[model samples]
Target: MKLWKRAAAAIKDQKSLLAVGFSRRASYRNTDLEAAIIKATSHDDSSVDYSNAQRVYKWIKASPLNLKTLVHALSSRVNHTRSWIVALKSLMLLHGVISCKVPSVVGEIRRLPFDLSDFSDGHSSLSRTWGFNIFVRAYFAFLNSYSSFTADQISRTRANLRSDKVDSVKQQLDRIQKLQSLLDLILQIRPIADNMKRALILEAMDCIVLESINIYGRICSGIIKILPAAGKTDAARSLKIVNKATSQGEDLAMYFEFCKGFGVSNARDTPQFVTIPMAEVEAMEKMVKSVEKDEQKQEEEVVEKAIVLLEKPRLQTIITDKWQTFEDDEYCFSEKAIQEYHQDPLPLVVSNQPVCYTMPDLITF
Candidate 1:
């Protein structure tokens, strides 16, 4: 049988795709692990952090891993990206080796505390907690906004962007300039220091908190569903809500511009649309306006019904109690949920998942 290098395993002359990670050194003769640790400590790369890798290496050499502290530190990717990555690499590699060396210790890691409470909604970082609920929610939003990730979708999206045949030379040049601006923005984003990842983490965490703490999302969804104005408001509201879907909307807009070579000069979050025939645009606009008018009338009726419902003491009490629950420190992803999770557990988490709490698509909203 042909000998192939093992994936994600520390090997003698193979590079790991992960951050500064290598297997435990079997012997001095087998220096694969040793070499990776040394490289990580001294150098920077697209994958590994110099210092974080070194610290991880130190822990590995000592044995009896500090799995709790190590895992906890992975949360520091908010500020220390490369360094955090190095630590992560080291943690995974050391854990792999340590687990095999002393299998009994593996169970102990499962008992370790996981901090998942980072509810930072694009404004500030929140504390960490140990839950995949938030992460699942963020994943849903990302998936919705990132519909262009696939080759098929990308092709279709690009096909949709058509420049007018009667466009003037000035328009063509302006389009090229806009395209170049998108490229520049991309360069800034590519540096990773542009806070792209941090923004995503914060935004993802924020989305969960925003949805959990408020009835706004539910209200919007309800309005779209129950109200007659839904058909009209759906477009505007969906655009607004779906606009918030991707944390990387700006980047995506730029990407679209890049791919289509079409001019996109609108705000980062707003979608850019290629102009269609004037008559088609007018017809669509008229339809949207008519729909909006119907939706407004429907919302008024809903408000009237809601006022009647609120007049009932029982319904008012229920609403008050529901709102009061937010005052408690005990929040989403309750202990009961965690216990249930143990029974029907998700797959073992690898990489960061953003470490998984900031799990955005839990139940697909």
Candidate 2:
């Protein structure tokens, strides 16, 4: 049954590819680009057609306008596909295109053109294909977030290049925290079942491992650079980040171990673990304490200043008369005069007739 479904999907993809090849709506070159995308993300997922995928990447890198065609073709193929193979391949192709780091592609693809968060595989029963479904969803989530991360990273890089100033410790730490978040998302792409050892699954897992290494390395480099400057920023915030990095290092270790056991070649060579020294953590703690103390001292000093200002004698004009004198002499008053004035209060005029003020009942234009 699986073989039959695979064959049908391949036939359908080939027919669609041929139809796109003959279509005159787009330029011949764009048609070819769309064809390449179709081929790269076809249902036959025994192995990824990286050649065709790279070709698409080259086309996009050459001219960013090709991205519109790419997005349309990739979205149509992925969104309409029921086969897990095609969905995964499409995601992998997108992942590669993003990896090319073409500024235009990165900026435009910050959010995916298609949604796969609720993707379900139709090639097999849900019970059997649940792992693939999870993998696809997880991969989609990571790619979506990672694309945004890449776009942001590129924007920041360009901004830094344009300016004479380097990124501050807070900026660096924020980037590291974001990379750590991406790592967490990538790590969630693990196979849910031991039987999910197919080449297609392994291929996707390999890519995940590679991305994890890249993100994890950047995170470690960032941590190293920012650790020395911890005192320069909010120490408590810095300390929280340091603790997360330490925990992420452990999670990454376990993630790679799982990858190696699950047959990812890249995981066999373990990346260097980031070890935040106890002394550094202690120093950060002390900085945090010192920061807290300084803030408390500032508050106390402000309070003391306020108290001293309050206690100090200040010249104040004293108005001995309780009554107020206005421009009208009749309104002038004194306490004793106020009592006499109230005793002989002015006469009140009471009108029994109701007087209504007319506001234009219906205003004319």
**Model 1 RMSD in angstroms:** 32.2
Residue by residue across 68-121, what tens digits does model 2's lDDT show?
A: 899889888887888888888989888888998778778877888899999998
lDDT of 2 at 274: 60
Residue ranges of candidate 2 with Cα displaced over 4 Å: 27-29, 273-280, 295-365
* CA-only RMSD, every prediction: 32.2, 9.6
Residues 1-365 of candidate 1: C-alpha lDDT, one tens digit per residue: 11231222233213432323444422222233344444442212134343545555455445544443344333332124222223223333432333343332343344222222232233123332112224422332322222212223234334556642343333323332333332233223111122333332332223322222122233223323322322443345433333332223344455444422322222223333322234433444566677778889999999999999889554433334344445244544578767888999889756743543564687875
lDDT per model, in order?
0.36, 0.84
Count of clashes in candidate 1: 23
